[model samples]
Target: MTDTTSTETAVRTGLFIGGEPRQTDETLTIVDPAKPGVIVGEAASASKQDVADAIAAADAAFPAWSALSATERATLMAEAIAGIADERDTDAAVLSQENGKIRFEGFIDALVFEIRWNLALMLADEVDTGKTLPVVPGIPVTTEVSYQPLGVVTVIVPFNWPIAILAAALPHALLAGNTAIVKPPPSAPLATTRIVQRVAEKLPPGVLNVVTGRDENMAELIQSPDVAKVCFTGSVNGGKRIMEMAAKTLTRVTLELGGNDAAVFLEDAVIDDVHLDRLFAAIYDSTGQICMNAKRVYVHRSRMDELVAGLEARLNRVVLGYGLDEGTTMGPLHQPAQKAFVEDIIQEAKDAGADVREYGTLPGGDLAGGNFLRPALVVDPDPSLRVVTQEQFGPVIPILPFDTEEEAVAAANDTWSGLCGSVWTADVEAAQRVGSQLVCGYVWVNDHGATRLDLRAPFGGMKQSGIGREQGIEGIRAFQDTRSIATIDPEALAAMAH
Candidate 1:
């Protein structure tokens, strides 16, 4: 993709408040993960006062924005979606520059498509509405339930796939008659802030807000009493802290937390070199930064060697470097710190007696400068090891041997987080049965992360993964209030009043 913005043009990089773009004295430098030394872009660092201003905007605009009919809200959402699409190349370029993802892989191709996929979820469903009310027992009276807006919502998104997740939560909140304050990840705020600025013109003032910063400034925004609800996506520790802060204001929250998802390979599963390669491609894509990335692989002891050998051979062909390079299957870790953390864990796994081997050579002579780590596969990993159990958000996979389907399901569910997992087997009944046994919000059979769910599927978790849903008709209900209105005939009312 090309940079659509003219060379002479200066990008309006700042905080978005009240449907306007304004800069702050404080600025945050966004790094290019591909070349750690290069400064790709900068975003305004919102102060406490800026956050207060955003909440104030949300508060002032909520009444009008919410007063519009669902059709009107949906129209504005559709316009914003179109505007975002118009800025696709620009957004993609900026995303690649700031995120250190390859322009095609990271920006236009991989994530923008996900954003559009999420956009399809924004179109409200008329069928799900107008549900009939249940009749009262021992009486001819009836009670109906309707959805109402929850007021101003604050969306705090994580770094990886910021645009997609924001699209996931924001449209649902707005369509339900609520305004939004979007807090982009501090590390890569430029793309999101700019996208919001470009699209804000399509909505009424205060309908949506974007604030960027590095510290607790946004935390105060999430905890503000003026903010009605908070939707967050990040690590478990970060989520816990946000929940605690939200509790002070009794703020409603939807926490999409971390995941330690796994993939199970049964002995009966059809095995071929081509199939194994395709599976590795899905897992290692995006350097395994995806929340649902296969962090752990449980293989039957009988086929463990075959799977390991196939994975190692396929991984050897992956081209690892900056995302912009052609055929670069593996990009650098999102940050230098992330690279260090992944390396530490890999060494830890090796120290734990697991045999570790690298597939591709590190990129360039200056591998130390960039945040790249060669994709690695650890064989015969102990189930209790940190690499096997924890959410290692990197291009590392740990292989563990399992004896039976029960053991595989048990191993998959033995985690603090339950976001998503996958089960592979030849028997249709076995796949469905074992898939149900794994404790997760979403599961894939014979697949890794592809889902065909519409806006009507509830997207959330049961354990530490998250608190509330964020897709489909169920998601819109999350941003709404259910009130019971009771009525009776005049004579009955008189008798009840008496």
Candidate 2:
């Protein structure tokens, strides 16, 4: 990892609007989450006027951008993507410092953003592909059905995976011929702003923009009458707030919110070394900050001991430290508040007589002050415990044991969140049966978590988790509106009149 402290000047970021980098009188100081007192960078704190400017810029650019052919837009975006990798190392290191994720995960975040961008680009031709309907006896007219771009769009991303989550909608919106303004998470905006500004610079002025500021300054991004749609990926409450604000303009919204995903292991589940490794990573990767990571694990009562032993072995060997530290396997929780929240949840579980086993040791010296928490497993906790029932967006997870497949599925579906769920079993048929029964938007059979997610498939939550889907053809359509053109057919009209 690059030594961020080696340079005398800290990384400074500014808003990207109208293809220019603009500075703000007030700026947000971004610190290394792993070492909160150490300032890593600063981002322009967009004012209310700045937010309106971004929306106006996107609105101004929308007509020309939307007029372009899908192929033209795709070609320009491809050119921009080709240049994005030039600063990968620096960007990833900054992300690591600011987001409290291991360096490799930080690198993967940017890589995944590019991957999703390319994936969305691949669907360019399909954006303008319209279907023709033949004349019907009763209708007496032939019609053409087409998808048209919504105008200016606002895309708000969360702190956990800002760049990648922004890509889930940004590229698709732009490729579908809409102009976009991105609002990166306020706490971890430095690296995301740098990356988005780079991409925005290569595009047409106002075709893409980035604004970093407090939530209070961003009301216009959603409620502006010029804005056609808002794509937000964040907490459930945040999504609800976005919906309420957007409702003023009756703007369309695509929300990818929080999830308390469940992973079920059937009686015939494979608990081999490889499977255990995958399971461990699924539960604890990025220090368990991912929205889709398995928050609760439901194991067959027969294999509960085996699974617990395997996870314990892995947990005992974890190394917690700064994200850039080579020896570290897991970094701290992104913020001190989250650390406190997770600690409280674990204490609550322990008070309820659940066996809360925590592993790993915090590093000494300056690192001691970081938001570090040992990875923990709550063994066979009561289903009503906060760790089991709530979205524990931290490194602690609850493991519950069930006797029957019906019970496992019931327990998994009991949560208000239905984002994603997985079934683990050697029996493919059983995997299908149980996976199909889980009431989530996406289900994985035999494998689980973001590592196993299919980018080409649509991803989102059901119920309180989220309102709409992202990725695949469905994602592109989320940024668009359907239109129909019809003309009277003389012969068919005469026949129908007769």
Candidate 3:
């Protein structure tokens, strides 16, 4: 990992509306999550009028944008993406400072956005591909089935993985011929706003826009009559709120919400070095903030000790420090409230007599006041404990032991969350059998987590986890509406009349 400490600098960002930068008198000061007192940058605080202007701009651009062929739009998007990598170094440093992930993760966040953009572009030709239903031997009607753009769309991304998460829907919406207005989370808006503005600058005016501000000023983004669809990636409660707001206009919505993802290890699972490393990264990568990060681990009783030992061996080497520091293996929570929340959960488990072992040394000096917490593994806590049941969204995780494959699958599916789950085992048939039973949107066999996620596959949740899928062909179609054109064949019509 490259050291970005020396390059750290404050960023000032403005809203992108009608493809131009618009300044606001009021600004929201964004603080460094690693050092709360440190000001990372200021973002333009969009007002209700600004939000309206953004929606209006997107609505105005929808006609021409939607009229163009998917191939034409893709060519323009490719040109825009070509220059995105040029400023990645600076953007990565900015993201690390504000969001508190290590610089390498920040770099990867931007890179993933570009990767997803190209992937979405690959489906341009198929976006408009329609099927013709020929008149049957005795039928009189011929029909053409096609997909059409759904005007303006609003895309809201969460703070955890702003740029990468935005890519899950933004590019697809544009390629589907819907103009979009992106709303980056207020707490960590600088880097996202900067990157989105850069891309928006290269595209036609009003084709893409960005708004950053307090939640109080964002209702119009979702409820406005002009917004045909709203795609949001955030908490379950937030998704519900978005649904309520969009209900006013009966606008369409696609929500990718929170999760309490589980990882199950069968009795025959391999507990070797490679598998152990994969498990560790799957659980702790991004400090366990990822929605798909394994929150609870269920290991068959036979492998419990080995799995715990392997995790501890890796946890013992964790280094908590500033995200820009090259030596830091993990950074602080994105906010103080989250740090306190995780700490309270760990304390509650310890108070209940669970064997909770926390590892890592907090960096002193400048980082003394940072929202830092050592990574912890709670060994076989009561299944109902918050550490096991809730989405920790931090560096602490619960590992429980099960007696059989049936018990493991049951334990994994017990939660209300159905975002994702994984089954690990050497027996291919067992992996299949257990993985098929896990009640989640996507299942991983032998491998797990975001690092192992297959981007080409449809990803989402079930029950309260989410409303619709993002990515793949399914994701592209989320921004479109279907149309059926029917014509009566003269000969068939005459035959029917006779």
Instruction: Give the Cα lDDT of each candidate.
Output: 0.76, 0.90, 0.91
Better-scoring candidate (TM-score), 1 or 2? 2
Which residues of candidate 3, in runs, are more than 4 Å off?
1-8
Q: Report how far residue 344 has shifted in candidate 1, in Å.
A: 1.2
Write model 1 residue lDDT over 1-498, tens digit each, in one string. 124332122343788899887788988877677775666666788888998999999999999988887877777677666645666667766776666666664454335434643453455664125544544434444556666788899988888778877766777888888999989889887777777666676789888888888777777677788889999988889889988999999999899888888888888976686568657855786678777677888989999988888887788788877565567777788888888988998999888878988778778764457888888988887777778878888888888898987888888888998988888888999898888888989887776742223334677776999898877666777888877665544554455556
TM-score of 1: 0.92
TM-score of 3: 0.98
Poorest stretch of ten by lDDT in candidate 2: 1-10
Overlapping backbone residue pairs in candidate 2 total: 0
Q: What is the TM-score of each candidate against the true structure?
A: 0.92, 0.98, 0.98
**For model 2, how does the per-residue alpha-carbon lDDT over 264-381 read when each residue is reduced to its tens digit?**
9999899999999988998999999999999999999999999999999999999999888788999999889989999999999989999999999988788878899989999998
What is candidate 3's lDDT per residue for 81-160, written digit by digit as tens?
Answer: 88888889888888889899999999999999999999999998899999999999787889999999999999999988
